[model samples]
Target: MQKMPQWADVVLIPLISLILAALLSALVILAIGENPWAALKLMVEGSLGSTYAWGYTLYYTTNFIFTGLAVAIAIHARLFNIGGEGQAMLGGLGVALIALFIPWPHWSLALLGGAVGAALFGAAWALIPAWLQAKRGSHIVITTIMFNFIAAALLNYLLIGALKPSGSMEPATGRFPEATHLPTFQDMFSTAETALFRGAPVNVSFFVALLACVAVWALIWRTRLGYEIRAFGQSESAAKYAGISPTRIIVVTMLMSGGLAGMMAINNVMGEAERLVLNAVEGAGFIGIAVALMGRSHPFGVLLAALLFGFLYQGGAELALWTSIPRELIVVIQALVILFTGALDNMVRMPLEAMFLRLRPAPKPARKTEPAE
Candidate 1:
């Protein structure tokens, strides 16, 4: 059999997977006595039909972009850093502390404090599992999964006891000071008629996410560290033979990956929420894995995939307002996309190979006298 064309895989695989997922979802919608067309129309209209919806979608996508990059970086090093949720939560804690305690006269200082605090906390969260994996040969998957539970417990304790606002019964910290709050786009959209629609709070986090994507692209495709990481992912044995230390690579990759997730904490605590609220991240860390997978672990690809998820989430939330379809149905769509992408990848390889072979020049007819002349 001939080899598959690389371009064919890049172009057709995702398209086919999306089409298949849509069809399957339509069937499922019918089974539940809902019109798929209506569901889809609602999704599109609610997500992209208005400026407010677009702004919200962008906000959500920014979170996904950072977290997805984190996962993608670890994946490139052959590590599955499933502790992104924990890392992000810890980072949020750090940002909250900074916002609460740091007396910054300037907004710039506050923003810097938040970024550094989140990065430090995230890196620390990742270090524990990295240490276990490197020193004791522990399985990262097991350790990271356990760490998520630990983080949740720790966060609940802190929010209820240490960080809870004085005069509030809710499981959340005090609102950030005015200096620490992210500037919103509300002022830019202000008009005479409807102030509610104008006061939408979108922040600079989206630009930060875009910059992170560029940095990740450079790190992965333009640096020696990235090459070594990719090498390890392709084959650890080969990487070892090539003198790349797996332990060091593993630890660094996890730290960098977790740091990116930590940035998501900034988007939450500093950019959007401006406070430490329970479940503030809203499962964005786990959703990041889906984004990374759908994007094939590429930085730019992850950005697009994250945007798609953001649209789905915003659209699904709006759909729930007027329809019987459960919001959880969006999660079902996400799962189907992942499953179909994997399955269709295998199915398409054969056809891609045939097409590549047909496009290649036919081998010169073997010399008739090759046997003995």
Candidate 2:
């Protein structure tokens, strides 16, 4: 018998965690001499109020979606692929190479090429760590984390030397070809008289993120490989007995995870910046961990969680801009949300499960057994 319904696990638990995070955040604001209700109002107004705001929120959402899916996939295989930061950096390098060198006649072709490059680069970065974990006794967590620094250093070297344009001091490559420029929301949605998403960074890559979600959903639920991944996650010994190879599952899952993380570059680099630059990821790679945790490693859940964090990000920026609250306050709020959803998840889940179990009606006592007749 289940302790609670599936719906409760998927929806109710996260919702409660979010509310608790919000309440505690409100208290924090009050302690800082700000009105909680007013602050909440401002956040809503800033993040969801206008098309301009929605553009920023959705832009952030797009990045988080890719990174969140990246993390969630590895999570299903019980692997902590925190090297998303490094993988994504390499992906950006790939994007830069393709966008700067390839003379694409159209943006669509460039976008496709950029995606392929990003995925390849990201997957390549993950390959070493995956191989180490699968073939050696090396721990994946430590290996992946160490790789992040390596990626950073490698990127720094290339940016300052090989990738930098001659006579230019900037550590980033020159602007991408004009044909590679993506159509932003304003370009796609504006009318003659009015503009939507004006000056916003959101672009067609958002659709790519959505497509990724659908693909991941199908991969996890409808594919044999996914079944093996989940089976391995559930019990390596049992999966081994069933003919599933742990080594194969780990390598494949990390590759997919790293590829997804790299895809984020198509949004931030090709779409928004129109060029690859250092720190282009803006910590979205790490935020993806919280997104995956809150979403419980489901694609749809990752989408919703990504949106929530996107809102918090844009809203927090607005809050800091207009109020006395410092920018770091948003970080505090994010940390609190992570604390409740990730670390303290059992605090909410256990209580809810017990309540639901108690609410279930007692089964009727078995009829008294008389002598067999």
Candidate 3:
């Protein structure tokens, strides 16, 4: 028998699983007395049917890219950094405080201040759990999870008591000054015929996200620091033998991870909301875990996975407008993608191995006769 190809195992498995999931979801729609074809058509149309939809997709993609990179970085170090949500929230708070209180005559200065403030706050948040893990021998998963709650409480107190806009019952801070806000392409095209399209909220942050992707790819592939991180990830004992300090790597990994997450504050405070608000992170940090997993922790893969999720997020809302289907379906689909991708290694390996073994040549009868003799 001819040898089976290897790429089939790598690429085909994911493709088949996704197709199966879509078919299953369609069956579900049919069972619910809805037209599966219509629902599928609606899903596509809502996501990619127009420039407006594409713009929203890219907007959400920017946030997902940052958060996904944050999670992927930690995962590469073999750590489960569940505190991404908290880190992002604190980062937003940091940026908000700077933008609100600091008077900057130039937009460049304000933007830089906000980014730096967020990075510092996010680093601080991750440091707590990193310290617990390295010094106290606490499991990072548990420590990070607990820190999320603490962050929530801290944010609530600040939003309500300290940063609350005067006369507003909402748990939010005052809007940033116009000078501090990020500029978008839409601002220049305000009078164009495609004003609505031009007025869309896409901003320079998209380029920031792209730059981040390039930086992450370079860090992992070209830098000595990246080698150490990968070594630690593959085996702690081997890394230690190679003179890599596990504790230092752990701390550095968490810090870098949190710093990337901090950049998501740009999307929240600079692009979308223009201010800090309670629950502003809105679980993007957690969704990022799924994105990283779906992307198999590769930088470019993360970009593609993030865009897929972005489509689901923005399009799912538009889909709800035309169909009775709940927007929660998007969450369910996201969960399914993560579940499928997580099982991909096993799914690809086991079946291919079985097929290969079955196709192998049988042992010679002469060998059996010689053994008997």
Q: Please list the C-alpha lDDT of all candidates, in the order they appear.
A: 0.84, 0.92, 0.81
Candidate 1 at 118: error in angstroms? 1.3
Error of 3 at 234 (Å): 0.4
The pairs that clash in candidate 2 are none
lDDT of 2 by residue, 29-73 (tens): 999999999988999999999999999999999999999999999
lDDT of candidate 3 over 131-198, digit per residue (tens): 78877899999988898899999999999998998899989988888888677646643464665435
Error of 2 at 21 (Å): 1.5
For residues 1-373, could you state the per-residue lDDT of candidate 1 as single tens digits? Answer: 5276565566677777778788988898899999999999998998788778787777788888988999999989878988889989999999999999988787678877888899889888999899888778999989988988899999999999989978899999998898887655554455677553344445766777899999999999999998999999999999999999988998998999888998888787888888999988788888888888778888888999899999988888887887998888888888888776654567756676777787886665555457655
- For this target, which candidate reaches the highest TM-score against the unseen true structure? 2
The per-candidate count of clashes, in order, stands at 0, 0, 0
What TM-score goes with each of the models?
0.91, 0.96, 0.89
Error of 2 at 3 (Å): 0.9
Q: Which scores greater on lDDT, model 1 or model 3? A: 1
* Model 1 alpha-carbon drift over 4 Å, by segment: 187-197, 342-344, 347-361, 364-373
Query: What local lDDT does model 2 show for residue 58?
Result: 99
Question: Which 10-residue window of candidate 2 scores lowest in summed lDDT?
Answer: 364-373
What C-alpha lDDT, on a 0 to 100 scale, does residue 67 get in candidate 3? 88
